[model samples]
Target: MDSGAGTAVGEMFDEMPQEKRARIDAGGEDPPESSWAGLHADALGVVLRFLPCLADRARVRAVCRQWRDAARGRGVAPPLPLLVLPRFRFASLTPGGVLSAARRAWMPPGLDAGNACCVGSSDAWVVGAGQAGGECFIVNAFSHEVRRLPHLGTYDCSLRKVALSASPESAPDWIAVAFMIRWSRPELALWRPGMRSWRVCHHALFAGHIDIAFYQGKLYMLWKFTPCLFAFELGDDEHGVTISRMKDCFIEKLLPTTLGSTHELSCNMVEWHGRLLLIIRYYGGYQARHRVKVKVFVMDLSTNPSVLTEIHSFGSDCIFIGSGGCKSFPAGQHGGVEGDLIYFGPDHYNPHDAFVYSMRDGRTGPIFKPLPCVTHASERNLGFPVWLFPKE
Candidate 1:
């Protein structure tokens, strides 16, 4: 691990109790100095495997020379998804379902969270843009490393969402896509690493509030109310810039009759297990705390006409839905229950409350406990919780 990585792990341990550190140092029993140093490399690798948390792994590496060598030789699994809020703060959801504040000294200098909005997250990098100045940049939340990108001009405030094709660590050909709403009309923009300016695409079909996702080398956008989906191929050629409508991919037809009323609706598009999933959220009352309902649909593009199928079960996969973006991960991977379940409530206005909806059995309840950092009075002032996956 690098020095920055070691510092992050040390910070996490700083919050732990001295008694806990003593227990870890003892390693269950007193052992001869030679015996501890004589442990085989393979044996140490086995111990490191169980320490899935990055902080835990880093702490182990700092224990001694032998342990650091063992950690360097072993492969570490990706860290669990973290919850990121404004002001450069992070919280991790433990396997026991408790939300704990993570160590904070990883933010770069002058990285203002008040005027910044996280539009996208990929490969552990939070793609953020200045809401007032049209400035765009990428920052590694854990490493405190920052990469400044070209500004998006005066349309930055209009930018509602952004997605990255690949992480900067992977390659320099990575692309950043942004969906902006100007004058109540939506526009798509693309920027490559070496580009001098963003390539803007304005079309009538891009109108209305929408959500964007990059999956399988293609960019997808879904209009909030309508079932229309616009697909764009990602490449450097002119044809790659053109937006094509997937005529057969209509979602409104699969919706229940109860959704056709005057209720406000928000739709999210997510790609999981090589399939496109659409989640529709229905808001009832006109007030801020409105009654909410949700529906899940998967698009069957293999069919001759690409029909939308309403699924009541997600099997072993669980979906995380929030204003930032929707993501699906294996339930067992995170010690969560299997079957169709939706974890919702990363709200900017109501961060203290989270609800779990079970589509398999049709039940809803408060499963997500509020984090200590978010208070009812400060909820409106703080940024919404954005889910983040540590970089590989």
Candidate 2:
């Protein structure tokens, strides 16, 4: 681990150290030397929770009825998402950085991680809308299930980004929202259970570099151009989708970079605790790698102007923003992943564009610095690196 990496607080993760290891037998079967089925329910639950690999945990649940019941008792809170690398290699984000000896993340059995362009991920679900005329679907990693969604014919434009309101494991009412860009036409595509087809609407608010996020009871879109926000409420009746401007589309705050500067800015909106955050990333113009700068702001609706106020610290919690999904994560919940930081996953052609931003001293560093397992050699056109979270 890098000495300059970070401090570890695995204890705050739960009732025990964050790094828990289980003696996962081959094929998830109990050893013949002991009666695995005879173990206490709580004891079995602890082992199931500690399993480093999601596939192993899923297999453990299939061992027997007793094991399945134990697996139902999940963790206290949503653990940090697994950093899904190119070729489906999964690593855990820790205080020491990405670490994974098991180095595995579960996905739908047939889903091709290499060719698939995943739009968004939340809880345990990953949503993908590939080529325009191709298939679009939502797959559950833990359950190993996939649901097909509607796709436009000859549209020739794929979904740019997507966000989920909740995980499928939780309930059937979760919603999936996508930013659809077809030629010069931009719109919002939405779907939920029982919907025959996606409910979409063409709107000018979809223009500019936009990222969508679901918070509270409404969906929000942040336009990277002037840094404006648009909120929408989904309806099942003739309303279709109700769209409104947040604070009437206020632009009180602007990107930090000034004109004549060879830099680029990208923004993402996420919900942290009860606060909605907008994290703007600035990098060199030529490439995603550069003197990277990150700034976070909390949406202040109480104010008259309702501006995005810049925040210096994230306390102990941290933020993860990328093509897969953007959100605020609790402190030290997975491995040694510390807080007061921001993990970046820019979807540049460069697969190694990912990095970490520390709010403590305001600096950028390698995301895989502590772990030497990642060697992005021979990897090409590996779209967005995904962050796969657990299914609760």
Model 2, span 1-392: residue lDDT tens: 32122222111112111223122322343434335667787787677545544445545765554565566755534545676555444556544655343243444546664455667777766776555546677776545478777775545565667777887667678777777667767777777877776777676556736777887878877776346776676656653343433334464344354631566666677788898887776666645456767777888655666766788998878788777677777665544456898887755323456677899887777776543433344433344656766744
lDDT of each: 0.63, 0.62
TM-score for each predicted model, relative to the true structure: 0.75, 0.75
CA RMSD of each candidate after superposition: 6.6, 7.6
Ten-residue region with minimum lDDT total, candidate 1 = 1-10
Compare the candidates by TM-score and give the number of the best one: 1
Candidate 1 TM-score, C-alpha based: 0.75
Tens-place lDDT digits, model 1, residues 1-392: 12233234225423333344346566764334544666787888877656545556656655654565565636544555666655445655454434454444345557665457666677577777776436788888645578887787774345666777777888777878887766556678878776777787887777656777877777877876665676676656643333443343555655676764867666778877888898876767446434777778887755655678777777866677665666776655433334467776455323444666777776666544544444445533434556677632
TM-score of 2: 0.75
Clash pairs for candidate 1: none
